[model samples]
Target: MNRQDDLVAEGEPEKEFNPGIAARLPRKTVAGGALIRDPAGRILFLEPTYKPTLDIPGGIAEYDESPYDACRREVQEEIGLDREIGALLVVDWVPVLGPWTDALAFIFDGGILDDDQLTLDPTEVRTAQFLTLTEATPRLRPSMTRRLALAQQALTTGHPSYADFGRDS
Candidate 1:
């Protein structure tokens, strides 16, 4: 008897293909950033050489790293600021329809930094500046403005905030 005929005579049930595990969707990208403040009450903005937009002091989280840890690491790597990150401020869900999926961004509170403490990394950051909301308004993208607004609110209210790319109130 052939292999198929022998199996049928052995009284063993056929093994059905189960594709359950492979059907799961990929997880969204996770990134962490920091909203650092100065004694003048202005927010810190990093001038990234790679992008026109003024970014906060943070970057993407590595696998197995917590959001807070990623924030600290980014700050240290990008600006050489070795400091403790405060409570989480805002979590923004940003969507991209192309090659990448959506992103879950966490903006954490980086306590005030003095002028002398900053050590900028020339490769990632060109220069750093402190700007008020009004001054920063024109520089940031619409989504970034909304996220920053929510982050400032979280700081004032001592609570975390969320936003769905400025869609959800």
Candidate 2:
């Protein structure tokens, strides 16, 4: 007998299959952005329209898009800088401590930008400017200041670095 006939003859009930929701695991947000420098070696910052704090050029990645690509795209969209991103400078795992969920944030090396190429979209970015680390420190949020410090260290050491909420992980 065929497999179906054999099963029927054995008086065994057929099993019905249901593909319900798959198991859910704790999820973390992945955001990617870059620390761009100008010809003067000053870091770039975007004045965001939505938030009062200055931000590096980047945003949350869309579904299935790599974080690296997301960073490149965000730089182009936010600041109108269509340049290739360089080495990975920092990968920070920021834990969930407040309203935001846990996040894996990436900071890529955005090679120096020429003066003429600087552009901004006022709807998303009010302005863009380069600032020395000391100048940027007071303007950046605490976590961002930590990420920037680590990225600078990585650049100096010629090695990629990782951190968990500002502490080495």
In terms of lDDT, which candidate is strongest? 1
Q: Which stretches of candidate 2 lie over 4 Å from their true place?
A: 1-23
Q: How many backbone clashes are present in model 2? A: 0
What is candidate 1's local distance difference test score? 0.86
Residue-level lDDT of model 1, residues 17-120, one tens digit each, is 77564447577788889999999879999989988989899988888777888999999998897889988989899989578789988999998987657789
Flag clash pairs in model 2: none
lDDT of each: 0.86, 0.85
TM-score of each: 0.83, 0.83
Q: Write the per-residue lDDT of candidate 2 for residues 45-108, one digit (tens) a residue.
A: 9889998888889888887777898999988888887888999999999888778899999999
User: Clashes per prediction?
Assistant: 0, 0
* lDDT score, candidate 1, position 146: 89
